[model samples]
Each structure stands twice: as C-alpha cells, then as structure tokens.
Target: MSLTAFLHSRHGRGFSCRAEIEAHHAAAFRRFRARVMPRSPFYRGMADLPLKALPRMDKARLMANFSAINTCGIDHDAAMQVAIRAETSRDFRPLIGKVSVGLSTGTSGQRGLFLATPRERRLWAAIMLGCYWPELWRRQRVAFFMRADNALYRSLSNPLVRFAFFDLLSPFEDHLARLADLDPSVLIAPARILAMLAERQAAGGLALSPRRVISVAETLSPEDAALIERAFGTRVHQVYQATEGVLAMTCRLGHLHLNERWLRIDRDVIDAASGAFCPVIHDFTRESLPILNYRLDDVLIPDPDPCPCGCASQRIARIEGREDDVLWWPSVTGPRMVASEAIRTAIACLPQPLRDYRVVQQGRMLHLWLDAAAPGAEPALRTSLAGLARRLGAEPPALVFHRGLPPETDAKRRRIRVLPEARTGV
Candidate 1:
C-alpha cells in the first residue's frame, strides 16, 4: 500500500488501545530491525544483541556512529550538504525526494535536522490531522510562520490543506497584510511571535481569527502562554516538534501528550530524586534514519495523573528547559558550573510584560536581551531582571538594552546562551 493510504486508514483506529498499541509497536520494531540490521553497517555492528538487549543510545554516540547508523543507500555527508543547501534557499519546496527534512530553532547550541522517510511523513500527517485538527482531513487552510526555506516549507504543505507560509524574516506588517488575504482557519507559529500577533489582533491591526492557535519552536513559558491565551481569545495548543521528529503535543486540556504510537520513549530520569524523566526515544515510524534509543537533551517532569481531557495517551509537562540551560554558579577559584534551574524558573516567573527575552552567561556575568512592549519598560525590567540574576548567585551582571531581540539568521530566538569567555565583570 502507498504510505499515505495505509496511514490515513490507521487514524482513530484501535491503536489507541494499550494492548493493541503495544502489539503494533513490537511488530513495527521487529520489522524496522530486520530492514536496518543487515543493510546498515552501524546497526550491523550491534546486531549481535537481541532487540531487547541493545543498550540505549545517546546523541554523542549517534554522532560518533552516524556514518554507520543510516540505511545503506544514504550518505550522511551528502544528506547534510543537501539539508544545508535546502535551508539556505528560498524556493517553496526542497529538492530532497522521498526524504523529508525540517530544521529546528532552539538554543541547544546545535543545529537539528528532523529526518523522515516518506512513510513517516505520511504517518505524521495523519496523526497530526487526527489529533490536532481532524477538520483538516477534509480540506482546510493553514497559515504557518517560520524562517523561510523551501525544504521546511515543503514539509508543511499538503494537497488537502492550502498553506500560506509566513516568513519571520519578513516584517510583521507584511504578515498582517498577507494574512488578511489568506484568512486561514489555523495559525501555527513560534510562541513569542504568535504572542506578538495576538497583541496586534487585540490592537485591531490584524483581522483574521483562527479557530486554533498552535505554538511551536520555543518553550511556551507559563507567563507567555497565559498572555497568548488572553490576547488571542483562543486556547493555545502546544506542538512539540524538533529536528529529530514529533516529540509530543498538547491535548485539549492543555496537557502534553506524547506521540508514543510512532515513537517509543525510553526515558532517563535527570533528577532521580524528583523522578523527572528526560526522553531517549526509539522512533519506528521511519526507516531512512530510524532513531533507536536516541537520547535527547530536553528535561521534563512527567504528569502523574490522568489528563482530565480523557485521552488515555501518556502525558507530561512541557519541556522545562534543556539540560544545559542550568545556570552555573560562579566560583572564585575553581570550575564554575553548578546546579541551578534558576534561569529557567526565574524567566518563567517574570511578569507578563517581559514576553520575549534571552539570558546569556559569560563566566560570572549574566546578560539579558529584553523585548518588552512599552519603550520605557526597561526600568521595571532592569529591576526584576537584576534581582533574578542576583538570586541565581552572580551578584548582579551587566544588563544590555535593545529595541528588539535579535532573531538568529535561522530565525530562532535563544532563551539562554552560554558565553565562551571564562568571566565577565559583574
């Protein structure tokens, strides 16, 4: 069967049944193992282990064995070169055939590429449509915002859905103009940008009202989440997608539901004391670059209770921050890094006015990039920000003021960046 036909048939199937889901996953896993083991030099080396005995893998190991991990036909360096070329171009679609790649914008300090086979992409489309917008299965209009690149754009398009790509590189005014014409029913964008759009909608500058406002790319801080919710007058749904693949998504009740049917999560607990698990996923949905027990950098605290939304799927809190987002306590004489979730927690606690900002650490100093609504709001921001920094341990670092936060060329806003300099004056 064609990937799309087979996948579209699987929607809302008894796959949601735990017993059935487990059986399907086991069968899929075995099939994937059979396909990749003999052909992939990387998988071949580890083929001695029964599927149950292979050690869970991490990113470092993946990178180390990248050449061997992929299916026999793919050339890793060639694929990367194509991805880079696709990322740099302006066409509405990319050149990769039977291969789908989407770039990720996160402060993980690594450029992530989500690779999928034709089959995986088809399945992803089905599930995304089934859970997030069942209406789309019939024909609908979608307005999506992201850094403009043909490859990324191609992935978001479908014959059943009319999609208009909003380039973050374009001025907000331009988006408002085009959106007024597109009149799409759903708006999916980065959390901060969506919040900005919501503000414009409130100001009467933008006229389109989307039935759903989906937030992606960045972690939606609670304060920002409430702001978008209030500004748009719609429940903001969260989508957890990375260059790796679709990680999890928010259900109607605002609980994060993992896409476990396609990907199995073998979680590693970061704070074993608190029972907080970070994900190490085995994605059987795709074979081109099947992700087997691949550890990811995100840190999340799983939700223990069943979601009030009534979906039996596994759910968890939004990723709090990357493992490396921890603030390092400055030491007068020794290795300076120390355990502190202060940066993530402090930023989350900041009042609504400071909607978009970034914190950078250079040795002993903390630098904040502020993008507030009011022009003179810097004074209020200065006070609260410096206070937060001090509470994080550095006495008080230098604060830099800018009219707007700079979006990286790739269109990502880094929330926390670690500087190379050993120290910076407080």
Candidate 2:
C-alpha cells in the first residue's frame, strides 16, 4: 500500500499539504493500474499508455467494464441487482461494506450505487461534526432530508448526535411533526426545501431555529442561498456532495473549495464557442473502484479571483446549472434559450401563493406543473408564464396540475426534463 494510504488506514488522518496530496494520488494511481490492468481485460488493452495518459472515462465505459475494473470481485450485475432491490424494497438502508447503500434516481439515464466504507463513514462523521457542530458531536440531533436512505447514519449515530432519517418519499407532514418533536440543532436539506420553509417561516406557520443549516445535493443558487440564510437565521453552509461522495464544500466565506486531500478536481473552462465543458476528476480516496480522469456530465465555470481565505485548494465560482436543464422558450421570431437562473427569475416574480412548480419540455411544447394553494393562481400564472414563453420564442406549454413534484431518487430535484424527441428535433 502507498504511504498515504497506509498512514490514513493506520492513523485515521488526512493530509492538508498540496504536494503530499498530489504524491498520494500518483501512488494510488500506480497501484490501481497494476491491480486492474492485468485482471480486467478492458483495462489490459489500455495498459500500454502511461497511467496518467489514459483517456477520461465516462459512466458508459465504467458500467461496461464494471466487473473488470473493480478492485473487489463485486460484479456489476450483482451490484446493480442490490441497488434495484433497495429501490424496490422501500428499505433505504441496504448493507454495503459496513455502511448502507442508496441507489441513484437516474434522472439522466445514468444510475450508479454509492459505497461508503467503514473508515469513510467515520471520516465523514468527524469532518461534518467539526464543521457543523464542534461543541457537541453526540448530543445535537441531526435531521437529514434526502430521497434515498443514507448509510453514514448507520455507522455514525451516537447518543449525542442522534440521527433521524426523514425519507423524501414520506409525506411532508410526517417530517414536520418529527422535526417539531426532535427540534434538531443541525438541519441538512436541499435548497428548495429550505426555500419552502423560508416561505412558511415568513407566514408564521413553521418555527425552528437551527444552529447550522447545510445545503447539499443540488446547486445552491444565490436566491436559494439568501432564502435559506434568512429562514435558518444562520450562515448557510454548502456541501458539494453527490452520489460520488463529498467532493467540495464552502469554507468560512462560503467559497466552494475542493477537498484536495481526498480528490483532485481537473480545472478546465469553456470558451464562448463551446456550449459545455465536462470536468475531469481524479478521486484519490476511491480504491475499490478507481475514478481517475472521470468526466462528469455537469459543467462548472472556473472563477478567476483568488479566495480571500488563502486555502491552497482550488476554488470555483457558483456552480452553473447543468446544460441539460436549459430551457428553450418560443419567441415570435425564433426559439429563445434560457438557463435555470432565467426561469427562476420569471417564477420569483410570480405571486408567492404558488407552492411548487416544474417546467418540462417535450419537443417545442413546454409543460408547467404547478402546486398552488391559492385560487386564481392559474389565470395570473398562465398569463405571466405565457408572456415569458413568447419572449423565449417558445410556444405556450400545456399547463398541468401536480399535487407535488416527484422527488428524484438520486437526491437531485428535477425541475425540468427534455424529451428524446426534442434532442432529435422530431
């Protein structure tokens, strides 16, 4: 084993030095190459190239070479079957390692299962406790809101840090009652839910002042951040966590800094010409399944300004919305394309009575799913929405009423979806 891995395994500590982190990654890559190259026929074909020179791998390639690539003998089919069972059984926690397994909702047709090693769970607990609640690790109640049941709780729950799993599939009332009784000190949830809570707090319907509110799973937009900050009555922290794992986080100034010790974020950019630039990541911490030079579908625009915090780890400006979420509205002259921010702006201008909404695109037709509690919302909302649609060069979409937007299994809230026909121009 590499010195860093050996040290980490033995001492349960992480390196803060940039050079040391880089060296550890190089060593890990070497071991990974040696182990997988000979056993996995797929990687064996690419063994001639330098370990660092191998092309970035995407989800398709990783899934295709699953059994061959995994350092463990866990086959792709078996792992997938476990994930499927977890999704269908209504049991959030399926055993994986000493931790639990939660399946991704697969909004983008790419689904993968996350494995949390026992040591990884401990590290996550320690880091989170240090960051969120340093005063008491075991005492403060933590209420985590996510679609899939989290595995970290199984390992880390203690008398002090009592964990209450609020399944996203459950009714909102169930969560409200649980929170009212628990009165958790730390509240971790998606930004949109916080936004809803903020609205409730304003109307004097909900009252729970949390010491810390950590928003993760989705990109925390500026408006969402402000709303969460106002509702929580505390500085809202952002965790750039996903199915992959905890990748980055906001420091004291709320700047998104890479977890350089565990992962290497490939910094790249898209010029005015290119539509999207995929990020290339090398996760040093992942040994069971190597994630070197893995291309992510999401796009992140790099920030030029140096963070005032002076942390050596690289930083990025606000994570821009994914390319897939872009909305194409119909204008009088042509089709007008706008991003999530633009759509958010239009929705924000509407009356606050609209509880929830979703915009779905099918070919040139847009579908608006509104969960409104107020009467006469449709008339006012329809007019405003249709005007915006026309401005975007998109025809008025068919309006649909949904009791509630379905929560994605991947922990991501899907505000929009593009049908296959739209991509094919059918």
Candidate 3:
C-alpha cells in the first residue's frame, strides 16, 4: 500500500487527466457509500444522498458532533482528555487503543481534536516518506519540528530512518546543539522556523547539510522561500497540511498540487474577481474520522496554467493566509476582498530596502508596520498603498504607520490580517 501510494504521487502515475480523477472519485465514493457510510452514526441514513446534499461541516460543527461523526466508537470527551493530557505533559506516547489522538494548534479560535487509526498513520507516513525522504539505501535522520508531537508522526520511524521530534515549545536556541549532532538528512519545520535556521546558516552560527528541507504547517511566502534557497543552496519544498489532512504537496517541479489521490476538494469562491476561495475537502482516505464536506478557513489562489510536472490535480498559486487574514476594503462593488499580492507589491516596490513588515486592518484603519532601512519608508508606503487603492477602485483606509516589526513569537506569522469584520455596505 505504501509503495503504491508513493508511486501514485509521482506525475502521470495517480491521475493523468480530469476524467481519470473523476473516475477515481467515483469509485472511492462508491466504496464509501457501500462499506464506510453505514458505520458512521452521524451519516447513518445518508448513503444515497449526493455530496452536496450532505451537511456542510466546519471545525465547530465537526467537534459538536464528533462522537457521532467518527466511525470508531471513541467518545469525544474521553479523546479530548487524552489529547489534553499529552499536550500538557509533553508526552506523545499515549494513545486510545490503536487510534492516535492529537490537538490542533488552532490558529483559529478553538483547538481541534484529530484521531487517526494505525492504517491512517501508515498511509500518512508512506506519502510523506515517499515524497520527501532523502535517501533510502543509507540510514538517514529526519528532523520534524512541530507544536505538539503524536503517534501519528511517529509512524515515520524505522530501522533505516531515525525520526527526531523537535518540540516547538522549547527554546529555539537550546535545540541548536542537538540539531548539530543529528545533522539530519531531511529537515522539516514551520516556514518561520526554517527561515530562522536559514538565517543562522547564513550567519555561520550553524553548519549542517540536509538533503531535503520541507516547510510545513504555515504558509511559505515567496520571499522566505528565496531566502531559504539562497542560504541552504537547495530548493525548498512545501507540504500544505492542515488538521483536516495533507491537502496539497509540492511536486518535483516545486508547484503545489492538491492531493487529489486522497482528497476531493471543492472551492468555495470568496472573491470572484481574485479567484480566492477556501477548500471544502472530502477525504475518502480518512475513515476513522470522516472529514467530508468540511470547509477549511484557508484561502488559496489557484494557478490556471498547467504544471510541468503533469499532475492533473488543481494547482495552488499560493495560500493567501486564512479568511480572517483577508482585508475587505470599501470598493465600487461594495466590500472587495483586496488582493494581498497588490498590497505586498506596493510595499515591495518601495525604494527602501525594507527587511520585514506587517499589515493589520482594524475597522476603518489600516495599521502598517515597517522594518525598513530608513525612516522615510512610512510616507513612501502610505503613498504606494493610496495609489494601489485608487487603481483597485477602492477607498483608502486611514493609514496608521509604525516603525519596526512585531515581536517574534511561536505563533504562526500572518503578514496581513483583518482584526474585525469590515462593514460591507456604505
């Protein structure tokens, strides 16, 4: 199964055309209707219903109906207790039978609970190892940096592979010595953490060679990717995963293609003009915990052009952060979801060599933070943004500028975010 799934990920291996993809979906759903749907209490009598007819699910709704939705008879409250204990104690060894329970960091409001059976764990390991594993012949070390650890991740361990878990809760500096000793052949971490390590490498404070560097969990920006490449002298690969599942993964050509082998994604287009939308995923692979008609808050911009890698799955140009991260400015068409790239371009074209920045919108005010080479950056950024607003046919918000960047934390770094819901109508 591992080898087959691994081969399926390669271009022209799993899905060659739209028709083939549709056929795979048809078969998978057929199996689900016959074998899987009957077991789920939440979806008990809904086997004959089409996907659209099924209840639309989000994190909140899933959690509310967790006990009934899951095929396994695991109680939601019992699973939550186990997950919380493991998190607080920093011990990932515990499990409920063969099923592994873990918590989501919840960049959104409430923390989410996820469960995976042994079969699920093996499949996950197969896809990850098959795609990102550096060398199979020789024993290689894998450095996995995550907010929390779980048996779900431990499936990657074997005699030929030494999986090292780097807890994000600990000080970043303290892990340097261990990292040096491990000198892992495959390095995986959040985008910011990878960038931080890249910075260290550039500064000559760290010296280690890795065959693969994978950015996981959070959004990996173009600038940061370039920085990582320059520092490591290797192309940076990305794994677009959420608690929902491994939604997408970068191909050999470095283009992100939705994991259509395991998932059926339906885009809920938020902005018709920009073609940005959140993914409503139906993962036929996840049976222990069914994730059907589930909408994730992430907003992804689609790439219309075909990938050279030849994977017929949907191509993601970039993840434009969460829905809350999108700022809706007043436009002729009412509240328009402003293209974040436009704002980034405005700041990028600035004459100053700005190192970093943050943009957060609160009510009618746009708070801009600049870590620039010169104090003159504030006025320059303001003018650029005003021009952008004019070009987009939108009204410029009150620009409140601040010098320097926000303090670094373990939290996922979101470049642009909307603090409150914007008034859509004038």
Per-residue lDDT over 253-349 for candidate 3, one digit per residue giving the tens place of the 0 to 100 score: 7889898989899999998887899999999989988888999989999998888877789899999988877877787778777877788878888
Kindly report which residue stretches of model 3 are placed more than 4 angstroms away from their true locations once superposed.
Answer: 10-14, 408-410, 421-426
Candidate 1 Cα RMSD after full superposition onto the native fold (Å): 5.4
Tell me each candidate's RMSD, in Å, in order: 5.4, 6.1, 1.7
Assess each prediction's global lDDT (C-alpha) against the native.
0.64, 0.65, 0.87
Question: Which residue pairs in candidate 3 have backbone atoms (N, alpha carbon, C) closer than 3 angstroms, thus clashing?
Answer: none
lDDT of 2: 0.65
Ranking by TM-score: 3, 1, 2
lDDT of 1: 0.64
Give a tens-digit lDDT track for model 2, residues 137-256. Answer: 347878888776656655447667778777777787667877878877888887777676677777777788788888877777776678778876888888877566567777767777
Q: lDDT at 354 for candidate 2?
A: 73
Ranking by lDDT: 3, 2, 1
Q: Return the TM-score for candidate 3, rounded to 2 decimals.
A: 0.96
lDDT of 1 at 14: 24
How many angstroms is residue 144 displaced in model 2 relative to the true structure, after the best TM-score fit? 0.8
List candidate 2 stretches off by more than 4 Å.
1-52, 92-100, 134-138, 267-276, 327-339, 342-426
Name the best candidate (by TM-score).
3
